[model samples]
Target: MIKPTPNPPELDDTTPYEFPGSKRFHEAAERALDHYLKPNALTLRFHKPSTMFQIAPDQDNESLLAHACESLASASIMTSDIAAYVDNPQRHTILAIQQIIMLAELAVNRVLDNVEMARSASHN
Candidate 1:
């Protein structure tokens, strides 16, 4: 019979992420451990970023930091999503970059919190 609705998707016995026997329920364990427990901790060195785009001086620090946090968050998501389609050792490199972006986003969030706290304290 030519019904209006299409056939339902077939169910699978297992999911792609069902690697309990392999990694044991933690997909990000290796990345998290590698990030925190590396021997001889790596130093964060900075290079001058391109000045082609910049926030206006009139913008408040909290707003600027908030925008930076959002931007880093987006970048981190992009790298992680792309990494899923990539094969190692390139996938490892992309994941590492995502980890770094996550760290930067966290730092920016911290600074934003500090600025907001100070602003509140000044108002009190």
Candidate 2:
């Protein structure tokens, strides 16, 4: 089941952040949308005060915590695959992988920024 999201006051009447590399950033976003967004039908479910930290009593926050842990584990596994350069081992491929990793980090930062904004707003 899905719940309705409350309108975020911080997001109200505010322009989205236009960081440098916005074009490439958008291209990557489009790629992501085409890949995961369409395939998984991920929706933007904003948090509300009542539901922000909501959990079952016995092991209240375990589900959310476990989700985060599992995400990290998945990333680590993927990183090992990306770090593998046994075949040609060309410098260019290594450099390209580095760039990909940098871009991935930037994407993670953007996501964290959004999360931080939500968290800060929730504290208000």
Say which candidate scores most in TM-score. Answer: 1
Tens digit of lDDT per residue, candidate 1, span 1-124?
7867557855668865655575554557877786778643233344456789877779977777888899999999999899999899999999999999999998998888888889899999
Per-model TM values vs. the true structure = 0.56, 0.31
Model 2, residue 114: what's the lDDT? 70
Clash count list over all predictions: 0, 0
Please give the CA lDDT of all the candidate structures.
Answer: 0.83, 0.60
> Which ten residues in a row are the worst by lDDT in model 2?
39-48
Tens digits of lDDT, candidate 2, 14-93: 43446768767888889988887564433435433466666556763434444554565566556556567455566457
- Whole-model alpha-carbon lDDT for candidate 2: 0.60
Worst 10 residues of 1 by lDDT: 39-48
Work out candidate 2's RMSD over C-alphas.
23.2
Candidate 1 collision pairs = none
